[model samples]
Each structure stands twice: as C-alpha cells, then as structure tokens.
Target chain A: MTGYTAKKAGYAIEYIALIAVVLIVWCVMAGRGTLNEIIMPAPSKVLDTVTELIGSGVLWTNLVISVVRVLKGYFIAVVLGVSLGILIGLSKHAERLSVLIIQIIKPIPPIAWIPLVILWFGIGESGKVFLIFLGSFFNILINVHDGIKQADEKYIEVSKSMETPFFKHIFRLIIPGAAPNIFTGLRIGLSSGWMCVVAAELVSSTTGLGYMIMNARQFGQTDVVIVGMLTIGIIGKLMDSLLRAVEKRAIKWNWSE
Target chain B: MEHKYIEIKGLSKIFTRKKESVHALENIDFSVDRGELVCILGPSGCGKSTLLRAICGLDTEHSGDVFIDGRKVIKPEKTRGMVFQEHRLFPWLTVEENVAFALNGVDKDTKAELVQQHIDLVGLTGFEKSYPRQLSGGMAQRAGIARALVNDPELLLLDEPFGALDTFTKMAMQKELKQIRKKSNTTMIMVTHDIDEAVFLADRIIVMSPRPGSIVKVIDVDLAEPRDRNSYEFLEIRKEVFNEF
Candidate 1:
C-alpha cells in the first residue's frame, strides 16, 4: 500500500520550495494589503472558512453530490464507450461508418453542450450528469478503439493458431491486451468528468462545490470561494493517487517484465 | 502404401512489403511419419519459422498444400498446437490459467486435472499460481510447452523454443524436452538454427539454406536414446548436419 515510498532529496526540495513560494506571496499580499479582500482573501481566512463548512456539514453534502454526479456519468460513459469502441475497432465497416461522426462530435468541448443539456433535461441532476457524460465519453471511446486496434498482431496469431473464434479471440486476447490503454482512457475520462461537473454546476446547479464557489462570489465571500477551489484540487489529487495504486497492481507486469 | 502423418508438396511463400516482393520459401517438400520428432534446421531468415506457421495454419498466403493426416490443412485447429520463440504466455494469466487457455469447453474438473498434469510434466507443478513475469526464461518456456500440450494436440510445433535461453538453461531444457517427448509420445516438429540441438533431439533433421529457402539435406539421426554429446556417433551426425551449411 506504500507506493513510491522512496523519497528523493531533490524532489523533496522542489515540493517544499513550491509551497514556500506560494506561502510567501500570500503572506506579503495580506500584510501589505495590496489586493482587495474580495479579490484575494487571506489564506488564514480560507482555512477558517473550510473548518466552518466542515463543522456545519455543508462541505460534506456538496462533496457527496459532486462525487455522485461524477460517478453516474463516468460509469455510463465507460460501459457504453468500451462496448462501442470494441465494435468499431474490430469491424472495418463499423470503423468506416462511425469515424466521421465520432471525429465531428469529439472535438466539441463538453461545456459547449450545456445549453442543449439544460434545454433537454432542465437543471436537475440528470442534466448535470449528461454534461459530464459528454465530457468523458469521446475520450474513453477513442482510447479504447486505439487500444483494441493496436493489440499485438503476434498475440492475435497465437489465438488464430489455437482455432479461436472471432469473439473468443477478442474477449480472451484483444480486451486483456488493450487493458493498459483502457486504464489510461479511464484516468483521462475522470478528469474530464470532473471538469464537466464544475462547468455544469457553474451554470445551473444550486448545490455543488462549484455552485458554492459561484454563490459565495455573489455574496463577496471570497474565503468560501477559495476553500471550495482548494477542496476540488485536493479531491482530484486524491482520486488520481488512488487510481495510480490500482493501476500498479493491475499492470505490474508491464513495469517489471 | 505407407501412411505419412504430415505431407507438404511444393510449398512456397512470397511476402510483399512496400511494393517489394521477397520470396521466403520455394518449392519445399517433406513428410514426417506418425509419432516422429522432426526438426527444421536453418539460419535466420531461412523460412524455417514460415514453414512452421504454414503447418500450424497461421499463414495461408502460400502456394501449396500441407496435409495433417489425410486432410488438407486450411485453418488452425486445436489438433495442432504451437509455441513461439518467446514464451508467449499471456502476462495477465497465471501459469495454470495459461495452460488451461485452450481447454475452454472442457469440464472444470477435467480442465484442472489436465492443467495440473501438464504443469507437472513441464516440472512447474509448484509454480502454477505464478505469472509469466515471475518465471525464469526456461520456466516460462516450460509453461508455454505445458500450455501447448494441455489440449492433447496431435502435433506440437515449436519455433526455436530454447533460442532465447542461456547456454546452460538451453541444454537443460533440451534434455527435459526429450523426457517430455518420451512420456507423451506426441508428434512434434521444432524449427531451429542450432545444429547441436537438431542432432540432440530430432529423429530426422531437414537442413535448409536461406534466400528463398529450399531444403539442402535431410539427415536421419540413428544414435541411441539418451544421446551423449561426446559420443562418436553424435559427433559424426553433428558434423554431417553442419556440412550442409
């Protein structure tokens, strides 16, 4: 469970220096009273706001809502994307037909769908999730397609020599071979999912970390905005680390072998 | 009047890459009797591996016929199991799982029993749960052999099975292969560039030369079983096979 436990002195120095620089800038600005309070709240004030939100159970509720929204969208995107991606990757006809459509739709930013999503689903949880799904689905699809397409021809020949059927070859050989790429797709999908959640909440939601930040901005509660932003960054980092741990166990052979 | 277990007549292969054509094999012909162990000996790029692929039905883009028993080989069948130069054991699967890979439709009890038996045959009984990455080069090749044998194939095709191993390990593996062949008595055809290996294991060695590879000689090893490297007969056969180079 202890991952990357060997700490290098150079890396440690870099991390400490980064934090020290941020702290010095914050302290100098607060002490000199150069920036207005509404624009750049004191770090201490932001920390105090975080504790207050935690004590009142507000932060927990927003965090859960945002997490639930992201999970819903991400799960749906993975299931549909992986299935269709495999289909399109294996079949020449499917690739020919879908490549143009996928290319046209994939490059459009997830936030650009906000107007349509809101118009179709209203400002409910479904609309927010739809936006997030749009954010993640295409990236996951493309990665999975590439993964299946790029499976080692040698392994495929192994399956062929075994008289393995097409479906069996795909499930037994291709999917597993494509796993490393699929994991990469999942990680990218997650960050994109998070981005969509915040963007969607910014425009229409009333009860997420993004909504909290936007709502606090209206009330000139700059400390609360900083707290919300910091919470998002911390959560994203934690999720990525957790994913890295799982990936290490799953693809350990890739490293040592 | 005599039955040939495997028959190849006028087999030829030409590959095209980037609008350039290269002849891999030309007008090759050979046959092996049932239960015989044969080795195709050649230098690198001499079409020995290509011949094995054609026999195993992995490459059909050739001009000729390969008959296993009385039937023309068309597509790959479970009857012909193959092991590549590298221990192509799937990284995701454990040793046991890799051996059981071909027994997809078998009953669970039968599958486990067969897997265990083959694992034991390859001297990997204790490492069944280990992944291919955890194994040594020889151990992984043993696992590959076990995987190929788990299906009880009529013919086991090996493409330079010990080419990647260190000298000592390769010698040890060659000895174990003899024992395995004696125990199972399954027909096998191995491709190799090593003349010593060809003399050590083959009942008959088909010597080939490169550049549109064609057979130059077919040397039958008449040495006794448990072949000794220092024996006069062994040296004579080795010298004879090397002379074809």
Candidate 2:
C-alpha cells in the first residue's frame, strides 16, 4: 500500500511539474512581449476570457452542444461498427462481401466527405453528426474486426464442441475475448469522433467549441480562442481517463500478476 | 462387453495443404462402454487429438460415422463435453460463470446449485469467483472440468487435460479426475501421450501409430480401482503397455 501511494504521488508531482513548466513559458513569453498578444495571449487574459464566456453561458452551451454532437455520432458508430465487425469477422462470406467496399471507403478521410455532408444535410446537426460518425466508424470496425479475429481458436472449438448456440457462443466466448481490443478501438474512435465534431463545427455549425474558436479568430479574440482550445484538450483528457477507469473494471481478468 | 455408449466406425481424416494431402487418421474403429474410461495413447502426430475431435463432432470432414446412444453424431451435442489440452476457460468469466456457460436455459437458482456442485466436485470449492488467469494451471484445468461437468454430460472427452500441469499437480489432478469419474459414472474418452497416465486412468488403452494413423493395439487392464502406481502389479502392467511402444 505504501508503494502504491508513493507511485501515485510521483505521478501527481510529474503532472504538476509539467503544468508549472507550461505556466513559466507562457509567463516569460507574455512578459517579454516576444510574441504578439493577438497570436499568443497571456494565460491570465485567457483565463479571464474563459470566465467571461462562462458568465455569459456561452462556454457551457457550446461545450454541451459539442458533447451532444459527439455522443450522437459516437453512439451510432459503435453500434454499426461493432455489429458489422462481428459479422465480417465471424464469417468468410460476410468478410468477402464487404471487404472491398470497406477498403475503398475507410481510406477516404472524414474531412474529404465534408462537402458532400454539407450538401446533403445543409449544415445541420445531421451533417455534423454524419461527419463525426464517418471519422469514428472505420477505426472501430477495423479494430473490432481484428479483435474478433484474434480470439483464440481453441476457445471457439470448445464452444462448438459444447454445442453452444451461434449467438450464445459469440456473446459468451468471442465478444468477451475481443473486449480489450474493442476498448482500444472505442478510445481511438472517441478521440477521432471528437476531432471530426470540431472540424465539422468549424466548417458549418453556428455554435460549438469549434465555432467559438473560429468566431473568436474572426474578431481577433485570441484569448477566447486559446480558452476554447484548452477546453477541448481538458475535456478530451477527462474522457480518456474516464474510459481508462472503465476499462480497468471491465477487463479485471487482465491483471496478470 | 458392456453396453457401447460411443461407437466410431471406419473413421479417416485427410488434410490437404498446397495440393499435398496428408492422412491424419485412416480406417480407425473403436467403441467405449458406458461408465468406462478409455484413453487413446500415442506419440505426437499420431492423430490422438484428431480422433478425440472427430469423436466429439468438432471435426466432421472425416469420412466415417460416430454414433452416441444409437444416434449418428453430425455435430457436437450437449451430452458430449470436451476438455482441450489448454484449459480454454473464458478469461473474462469467473469460475462459477464458466461452469454455467452451457446451461443457458437453466433457471438462476438451479444453475447456481449445479455450478457450485460441479465446482466442489472438481475440488475448486473456495475459488468460485476467481478468474482463469488468477488460477494456477492445474486449478484452471479443474475449472475447465467443472465447466464441462456442470451440464451433466454423458461423455467427457479430455485431450491431454493435465499436460500443462507440473508433475506433482498432474498426479494430484489425475487422482482428482479419477474420483470425479467414479462419482459421476460418466463415460470418459481421454487422449494422452503419457503411457503411465493412460494406464493409470483408463480401463482400456488404445495404442495408435502415426503416418496415416491407425490403431496398432488394444490393451485391456483388469486392474482394480485406486490401482497403486508404484506397486509391482502396476509396474508389470505399465511395462507391458510400454513394450507395445
């Protein structure tokens, strides 16, 4: 227990040191006037701008909108990707049927579809959600596919010889076996979805963290831009840590000691 | 002979890769009586594992018939439980969950009762909630046995179940397995490369030869229950079995 506490303390210290270094660099750059405030606002000014945005309810509304968008797209992507991935992964016929199409579409960047999405959905929630869905879906599908493929053949045989029903075998043996990799895909998919939401909002949406950053850039409010960027970073980090905690609980058998 | 519970007739398995075909089994025939323990013993690559797979209906491409209780074996059934060389327990599931894997339609209360009974039967009573990775190899295999037996299978097929265990654990597991078999009175068909294991556990040993594998000999042991492994009688039988190799 003492060793565990010391290790946790070490981690806290390391993070504190990193924050201190960033603060020092920001202070030095601001105080020396080495870079223009328009491009690199002082940390204090950014914090003040963040306070103003929150006071006016702009920051919270935009953050919530961005989060909602991400949730909608990510939820759909997970459902589609995992189901299709399992289908393709389990059967040679299913894989062969979709392999060509998947290979063709997966390589095309989500940004590449921005014009088409805007044309179809007319800069609405659907368009932005579609873009984020595209960004996350392929990553999830590929990882889930590989994860199911990586399931031990011996276990599959055991399930088979036990006369386990097809769906039961998948639920009991294959899915749990592929969980770690699926979690990997989910983490990657979430971050990519977050990226796509920002990109979509920048391109078309009227209100979101991305829109705030872009609107601030138009008015030369560098502080607000910095605040928006930092908010996105902070939220992303929080989501990742949340996922890590969940994975720790879900994959309890991974403790190999 | 006692009533035949499992019958394999003219079984043959051929493997083809890159236009080259290798025969894994050829014209093999065998029968296991009810409540009897039969071990298919051979060197590596002698189709022992393949034969077990075929009998359990996991390998259906073989060109013969396997009948269990007068019904043709086309696919694996709930009555035939199999244990592979590896423990093959689902890592995500606890011991109790793994044992309850095949009992899909069973009620929660009955499932719990039967799973607990099987876990105790396999001497894994206290570690019911432990994950597969947390257990030792022998313990994991015991969990595997409990999982197989929880469904109350008529025939338990084991392929080198204790092969990964240490010597001491292997011997202990063998004894535990014998006890479980005796208690359940389930027909067992085991495959092993260990001659002593076959002799110690089996009522009859089927010695197999490789390269288009076929049964070379059938040695029946009239030894009594709890046969002493180091006794003179056991040694004589062991030597007689070893001489066939």
Candidate 3:
C-alpha cells in the first residue's frame, strides 16, 4: 500500500512539474514585455480577471447555465440512446431497419448542424441542447448496441437452462454483462456532449464559457479569454474524473480481473 | 417397462454454413435412470457436448425428442440444469448472488438459505461475497455447480465441467463431484473427453466416435465405493474403454 501511494505521488509530482515549467516561462516572457498583453496576457492578469469575474458573479452564473444545458442534453441522450440501443440489440428487424439511417446520420459532425439549428431554434438554449444531444446520442447508441451484441452466448445459455424469466434474464444477465461497454459509451458520450456544447455556444450563444471567450476576444480582453479556456479545461477534466470514479466503483470486478 | 428418468430418441443435429452441411450427431439415442450418474465419453468433435446441450434444451435446433419425467423438452426448464465446459459464472456477480440467480418466487430468507446451503455444499463457504475473477478455476466451477444445483433440478447436465482444470485439480474436483452426487442423488449426465474422469465418476460410460458422432459402446462400471484408479479392476475397465477409441 505504501509503495502504491509513493508511485501515485511520483506521478502527481511529474504532472505538476511540466505545468509549473510552462507557467514560469509564460510569466517571465510576459513580465519582460516580450509578449503583447492583448495577445497573451500575463498569468497574473488572467488571475485578476478570474477574481473579477468571480466577484461580479459572472463566472458562477455562466458556469451554472453551461452545466445545466449539458445535463439536459446528456440526460436526454442517455435515456433515448440506451433504450433505442436495447431495442435494436434484441430485435433483428429493428437492427436491420435502423442500421442504415443511424449510419448515415452518425457520420455527419454535430458542428455541421449549427446552421440548421440556428435556422430552426435560433440562438436559444433549445438549439444548444439539441446540438449537445446530437453529439452524444450516436456514441451511446452505437456502443450500447455493440455491447449487447457482444454479450457472451454461453452466459445466455446458462440463463436459458435456468429458465430465467424474460425480464429477469435481460436485467440480471444481459444488462450487467454489457455494463462495461455501456460505461465506456457513457464516458465518451459525456465528453462529446461537453465538446458540442462549447462549439454551439461559440457559434451563436450569448452566454456560456465559449461565448465568454468569443466576447473577450472582440473586446481584446485576452486575460478573460485565457481564463475561460482554463475554466473549460479544468471543468472538463473534473467531470471526466467524476464519471471515472463512478465507473470504478460500479464495476470493480472489471478492474480486479 | 419402467419409465426412464430421462430419455433421448433419434437425436440428430446438422449444421449448415454457406451451403456446406456438417453432421454433428446421427441417430443418437440414450437414457438415464433416476439418481444414476452417466458419463458420455468421446473424442473432440464427437458431439458429446452437443448431446448434453440438446438434453438440457439449450440446443433445440436438433431434430429429435428428449423426455424428462415423461415430459417433452421444447425449451430449457428449471427442472433441468446445465454446467458448461467453462464455469460461465456471471463476472459481475458474487458467488452468493450467482448461486441465487435462478431462484425466485421463494421468500428472501429461503433464498439466502438455499444459496448458503449450496455454497457450503461446494466448499465455497467463505468466498460467498467474492466475485468470479477472485476465485481459481476449480472454485469458479464449484460455484457453477452450486448455481446449477440451487434450483434443485432433477437432472444435472455437465459438459466437460472440469476439462479446463489441471490434472491435480481435475482429479480433486472429480472426487468432490462424486461426493456431491452421493449426497444429492441427483441424476447427472456428464460429457467428458478424459477416460479416467468417466471411470472415476460414471456409473455407465457411453463412448462415441467423431465424424457423424454415433455411440460405439456402453460400458457399465460396477466398482465399489472409493475405487482405486491404479487397481487391476479399474485399469481393466479403463483399458476396455480406451480400446473402443
């Protein structure tokens, strides 16, 4: 246990070391006026902008708005994607009917939908949520379908021999068996949703970190732009870590084996 | 004529892939008396596992009839339980949960009791909470057996239950299986490629040949309890079964 902890601490030190080096270089360059403040503000300037945003409640308000939008889209994607996946997975007819349509729509990037989204929903939250939904839905659907298909036939045979009830068979055997893959889809779908929300906000939204970054760019507040980018990176990482933690707990058997 | 506990008649299976048909089993017929332990011994690709699957109703594509307690088997039922070559335990479930998997309609206490009883029967008492990955191959197979027996099935079908184990573990498991059979008196039909395993556990051994698998011989083992593998009688029976191959 001690050795494991020491190894983990070593990795943490390495991660922080690289970031510290980059920050020191940036600070030195900006202090020496080698870098223009408009283009690349000093770390201190960005820190001040962060503090100012926080004091004025702009950071928290926009952060809440972005998070709520992501949650709405992600929730919808998960519900529809997993249900549709299960439907297609269990029925040969459903799979055959939907495969071609899903394939055609899946390849078109979520970014490509921005023009149509604007034409339909304008710059409202609905369009942004729809864009995020599109980004995440297919990833989850495809993965869940694959996961169900890949469940071992042997286990199914055992379930059959036991005469497990139809609903019980699906819930106890098939779902748990496909859980690892479903979790993979969920994690990937979440990240994709995060990316799409930012892109949508960038293209048309009046709020969110993406809009904050764009608005700062126009006003030449490079410090605020830098802060917005940093916020997105940190929050994205945090969300991923949260999901990973849940995945680790829920499927401990996968890790041990 | 006395009604057999289990019966198979004119069982045949053919697999067609891309217009090429492979005959797996041809005119296979057999039966097991109540509380009797029968082993179907054969070489690989001899349809021993296929026959076991057909008996358990896991393979209903076969053109034939299987009757257990005078009832035709159209699909798998709780009255018949099966253990496969691999343990096939649910990776997500603990030993206790896997044992209790097929059990429903019973009260929670009864369910727990049955799960506990079967776990102890298989000598997996302490590892009830442990997942399949945490157990060794033999232990996992033991859990599989417990799960199969939890339903208290009248007939237990095992297709190479210990085939994946090392020689020592296989021998030990065979002994445990014998003890289990003695205690439960459940009708067991085991399919095995190992000659010694058949000799060790089976009351009657049905030997088969590959390439349209057909029963070549049926040899009854009348050895006394705690039969010695190295004894002359055991060797004689082993030799007789081996010669048929």
Candidate 4:
C-alpha cells in the first residue's frame, strides 16, 4: 500500500510537469493549428472523441472483445510456459531434448506468426489468440526455468534431509522460491498479450481497439486513432497492476527485506 | 555403566575424484555413553564435519557401521535431530513454523503446543512470527537449536552449532546449552574446533587428529556442575585435550 501511494505521488507530480510543458508548447504553437490532422491530434480533441465513443457504447464493445481474447490466450501461454519450464528444470533429459528446439523457435517474433496463424486458424478469434499465445509463451518459460535454477542449494538440502515428497518439495519450496521471477515473466507476457491482440486485430478483425484505430485512419479521424491508442495503453496498465497485486499477495514475505 | 548409545567401529570414508582416492576418515573407532556430551575438536579439512555428516546418515559411501542405539543409521529420521553450524532455518518460514516443520503428519493442537513450547524453550517466545532474516546471529542459532530439540530425538547432533557466533555469544550459548542439558538430560554430540568450547561444554572432549581423521584421545571433564572454565581442574583437562591435537 505504501509503495503504491509513493508511486501514485510520483505519477501525479510527473503529470503536473507534463501539463506545464504541453501548455508552453501550446503557447508557442499559437492557435495556428493546421487542418492536417493525420499525424497528430490535439489532446482535447482526443478526449472528446473518447467521450463520444464511450457514450455511444462502441468503446465498451471493442474493449470487451479485445480483453477477452487477450485473457484467454495469455492464460494458456502462462500455464504452458510455467509447467514446461518446471518440467525442464526438474528433468535433465527433458532439458536436453527441448532446449535446442526452444532456442531455435524463440527467436521468431510473435508478429511473424501472423501469416501462419491466418493460414492455420483463419482470420478470426482463433488466429488472434494463437498470435498472443506465441508472443507470451517463451518469455514466461525462460523466466520460470531461470527462477528454478537460481533457487538456493541450502533450502533443497533441508527438504532432502526431511525426505519431503518430490512434488511437495517443488510446489512448497521451488515454486515459492521462483515466484519473483515468474511474476516478472507474467508482467512482460501480459504486455506482449496486448501487443499481439492489437496486431491480430489489425491483421484480421472488424472490431477491436486495433480495428477502431484502423477504421479511424480510413476516415481521417486522427482524434479517434489517438483515443484507441490511449485506451490500449490504459487497459494494458490495468492488467499489469492487477498481476502486480496478485504478486504482492503471493510474496507478501518480501514486503520489506 | 551403560552401553554406548553411539559406537563407531573402524569407520572410514574414501572419496574418489577423477580416479584419485581421498581418505576423509580412516580406521575410526569411538563410543559415547548414553548421557555423555562429547565434543570432537579438529582443524579445518580434518574431516570433522564429514564425521558428523556420516553419523547423521547423510554420507552413505562411508565404510564401517555407526551404530546408534545398537542400530546402523542409513538415513536421517526424526530419531536424530541435528543443529547445523550455519543455522539453516527456512527463509520462507517464521521461527515457530521452521521449528515445527519436521513434526508433520501430527494433530494440529499437539503441533501447536509443541511449537510454542520449543519456541519458549529456546527463549524465542517473543519472536515466534519473526522470519530467519529478521533474527540476529545469536537468536537464529538459538532458533536452530530449538528446532533440533523440538523433535526430542534420542541423539542431538550439533555440527559446530556456535562456531559462527561471536565470542560473547558463544559463551552465552554454551551456558544456555549446559542449562538445557542439565534440565532435560538430553544426549548430545557436538563437533567443534574450538578447544575452549569443547572443554567448557563436553562431558568428554574427543580430540581428533588432522586429515585421515581418527580420535586421538578422550579427555574426561570431571569438574563439578556449573563448570568453572578458569578453575585448575578445567584448565588441566583443557591442556590434556590440547596436547592430543
């Protein structure tokens, strides 16, 4: 709670400074606002577009569609990544078998999967989710593996002395020990979730924040484009904050030292 | 006289590294009485810790039998509670939880009461919820001792339990240990290199020789209860154990 308050205080101060800078820039521009609205839109104009979209309920509809797809894809990615990472960590044979394949595949960016996802799943929800899953899986897997590898030897020895069951040892000690790293992976994966969803929408969707931006661009609605971009940023931040809250709860022992 | 609770007969351990054999312990035969507090003193790399580890059944490649209660120890169990040098309390758990961790598959009420009792036994009543990191060096060691004793094992194996502590803390711990032994009549075998620590705490100080280790001499401490370290008798015994090195 204290950390959140301190961060909020810092964000508020930054916003105040940002508003001051924008005001100075506005004065320098001196109302010579060109009708060339393709590249940049006025902040007030973007806000008005956001309000109009919200009032008409198109914003809610698009937001829900995008959020649902990202959630589904991101969760699948998290489960696969974490479980496979753990198996690889615990078993040397599994590690030797899969590490080379993972190294070869991880380099191919999630965006590059768009062509294949379209071919495999058609230009629909399935294609977009596959793209989002691809974006998140590798990062989460690597983090979980690293976290397990980094666990202290002494803790393992303690469990060994007690003769704790293999699964209990992993769940009770290894998982908790690797939690901070996994949380970091989740944060990164979730951001990738938004990017892949947006990219997917642009590639094949009729409705979504990405499609909203694309639709606005066709009509030269610069303010609506800015609104869609800002909404994406805000929603992405909310998901991250929610994950952080869960992380805090899980690793509450790490509150101070 | 009671038969020795622990009897090591020709115990030897040879470690093979790249086809080169290293002799860790060689032809060691030692015995301890049922109520004896025996502290083994030796130099670093002298296999003192290895001996303790072997007796605790963590080092299985070692030869010969380490008979505990006339039975060979093959693996660590609740029967022998060990207090390690570094106070290896689990970081995720508080003092109470760490102490009670080994008493699993028991009723909750019994576990809770035992946990609280042991926490109080080690003078950690107030620090029940404090994590290992939150504790001072001395306090953590005390918690470690408490954790070992909470099991109420037949043998308490201490591997340089207070070696990491400062001189003052070490003295205080020795005194606390004496009081605990007196109160409970617990059988303990501590491994330490400090001659003074051995003389001060042990009923019999088992002086161990350097590498390919073996018991050189067993100096009995015959001084009265609440031992006076400065007394002539204690000093004489200390000198005898020192000479065995």
What are the per-residue Cα lDDT tens digits for candidate 2 across B1-245?
A: 43367889999999998999889999999898889999999999999899998888888898989988878888887788898899989888999988888687889999999998999998898999898888999999999998888888899999999988888999999999998987899999999999889989999999999988999999998888788898888888899889987
Candidate 3 lDDT: 0.90
* Cα lDDT of model 1 by residue, B1-245, tens digit: 55589999899999898999888999999999889999999999999999999999888889999988878888889888899999888888889988888776889999999999999999997998998889999999999999888888989999999999999999999999899888888999999999999999999999999988899899889989889998999999999988887
Indicate the worst ten consecutive residues by lDDT in candidate 3 chain A.
A196-205
Task: For candidate 4, write residues A1-257 as lDDT tens digits.
Answer: 69999999999999799879976675445346753456676666667787899999999999999998888889999999999988898888999999999999999987787788888998878888888888888889989888888888877766666666767788878888888988988889889878777788867689888899899889988888878888998899898999999988887766665
TM-score-best of 3 and 4: 3
Best by TM-score: 1
**Per-residue error at A12 for model 4, in Å?**
6.7
DockQ (Cα-based) per candidate? 0.58, 0.69, 0.83, 0.42
Query: What are the clashing pairs of model 1?
Result: none
Model 4, residue pairs in steric clash: none
Residue-wise C-alpha lDDT for candidate 2, range A194-249, written one tens digit per residue:
88867879666789999998998899998988888889999988888888889888
Ranked by DockQ, top first:
3, 2, 1, 4
Which lDDT tens digits does candidate 1 get at residues A175-231? 988989888888888878887778879657889988988899899998988888888
Model 4 reproduces a share of the real contacts of 0.24
Model 4 interface root-mean-square deviation = 1.9
Candidate lDDT (C-alpha), each: 0.89, 0.89, 0.90, 0.84
Candidate 3 segments exceeding 4 Å error: A1-6, A28-34, B1-3, B17-20
**Model 4 agreement with the true structure over B16-66: per-residue lDDT tens digits:** 889998788888889888878989889877788889888888777788989
